[model samples]
Target: MAPNSSAPHTPERPGTPVIPGFAHRRVEVAEGVALHAAVGGAGRPIVLLHGFPQTHLMWRHVAADLAADHTVICPDLRGYGASDKPAATGPAVYAKRTMAADVVALARALGHERFALAGHDRGALVAFRAGLDHPGAISHLACLDVLPTPDMWDVLHGRDAAVGFHLYLMAQPPGLPERLIAADADAFFGHFLDLWAEDPAAVPPAVRAAYLEACRNAVPSIVADYRASATVDADDDLADRAAGNRLRMPVTVLQQDWGAALGYDAAGLWRAWAPDLRHATVDCGHFMAEEAPGRVAAELRWLLAR
Candidate 1:
């Protein structure tokens, strides 16, 4: 199917307007799904994936800066922002495997058979899968503020799990999670924008509104995406580990000191999966791309240089 130009537009979230000098287009990456991507600049391709509750607009600061020398492609993952949100068939439908394939297809469709890839939050999980499953296709991988599905599950036990209450809630068997979230979508989704950010002002009012609206519209798909992580996604990660599969590409992980909170070696866990790894803690919160784009962009450049 061609890009649906007639899709209903959220009044508050027009598009990625914060990032100047970029053209927005929806490219069909799968049989029924198409990703809404912002393409900008020209050079080596670098695809950036945004986290939850935010769209490609989260890459506004970093993408523009990287666009000077690198072709920055920021896409709203399936079920988020302006991208196609298909009904959740099962855990497999929203598995990171499926989402990772979308990224590969999106890049190839845009003439980048191989490219540098970076993702934040939920996007990071997809990128991790991309690096592991399609090593030949990703030259370098950068993940911000996330762990592999298995590692994530390993660390969440008691009080630490409280921090990720949303995860447990969304991982439930569907119906209730969607209904509860839809009841007060703005308040539910907007809470994360405020709670997860060290500096709440990092995400400006307009951008925050855009994120909230996007999440409100994408509640079911977003929940399905998370629910997959707890079930099918975790199983995939464990299977890969049992098979001794690791990401061979150069990898850089920028995260907060979640290790201290979770009582596990965050860097060590990532090091086990990525042989060529550079893991470090950032001072900012989970939304590092928006909270500290300069630092995030610098790290991405470093990953490319490696």
Candidate 2:
């Protein structure tokens, strides 16, 4: 399945914290992959997944705010932040399925067998797969600015092709996008970071600098993530479709109504995979998590209470 044409986006979660925690740190999740996990507060767990061109730092505001009430575990997905980027044997390594596993493993390491999840942009894709595969662990699901794997792919392959050029380019053999992207890292990745944002002024200078620096440094891993989506992810969706499994948790998706332009009720499409679903159109652009942190936080609390 193809990703939506929406610009890729991540952090700066919410208000001040109560318990005074959160010193930047790292942990070795796998042989070489040192996942960056920010742990704060104590209670039932809420694991956050950050979007592209950013990292766990994207959840800084939201995670810190949430940490006051519940244990918040925000990790830089494998190959994203200070996380180790391993050499890939194939697409499976960078596939969302694998990324989902990283989240699952990270949660287990943090002593959470059951937890709630919320993801943004690329992080949402990883969270979607995690919910489907590990239904028992993810009790509540929230996705920001994305569709399910199959529906997204279906939309991308047809009339809205131009909107998702990154899918085709990133899907290419390694070295191409990495080389080109690494050249003008800021302008390349920053284009989406700047464009998809509804309020550019909302993104503070420090936050903006952190995002650009991370994307520029992790071009190969980032490209591998998209590449795996094109190859292994395509096969994964086809396999899941053949098996006919749907998410078995209450699901909330807030996104731009690309459905109007792409031709389909986006919420209706989501119902095919999520039995319990609620969909809404947000006024902001692709980076809903960053643009509307308070609204996003309210929605997460809404899902949590549900």
TM-score of each: 0.95, 0.90
lDDT of 1 by residue, 49-102 (tens): 999888999999999999999999998999898888999987778899999999
**Which structure among the candidates has the greatest lDDT?**
1
Angstrom error of the Cα, residue 56, model 2: value is 1.5
Which stretches in model 2 have alpha-carbon errors above 4 Å? 1-20, 157-159
RMSD of 2: 6.7
Candidate 1 runs further than 4 Å off: 2-16
Alpha-carbon deviation at 60 in model 2, angstroms? 2.6
Whole-model lDDT, model 1: 0.89
Task: After the best TM-score superposition of candidate 2, give how far the Cα of residue 242 lies from its true spot, in angstroms.
Answer: 1.6
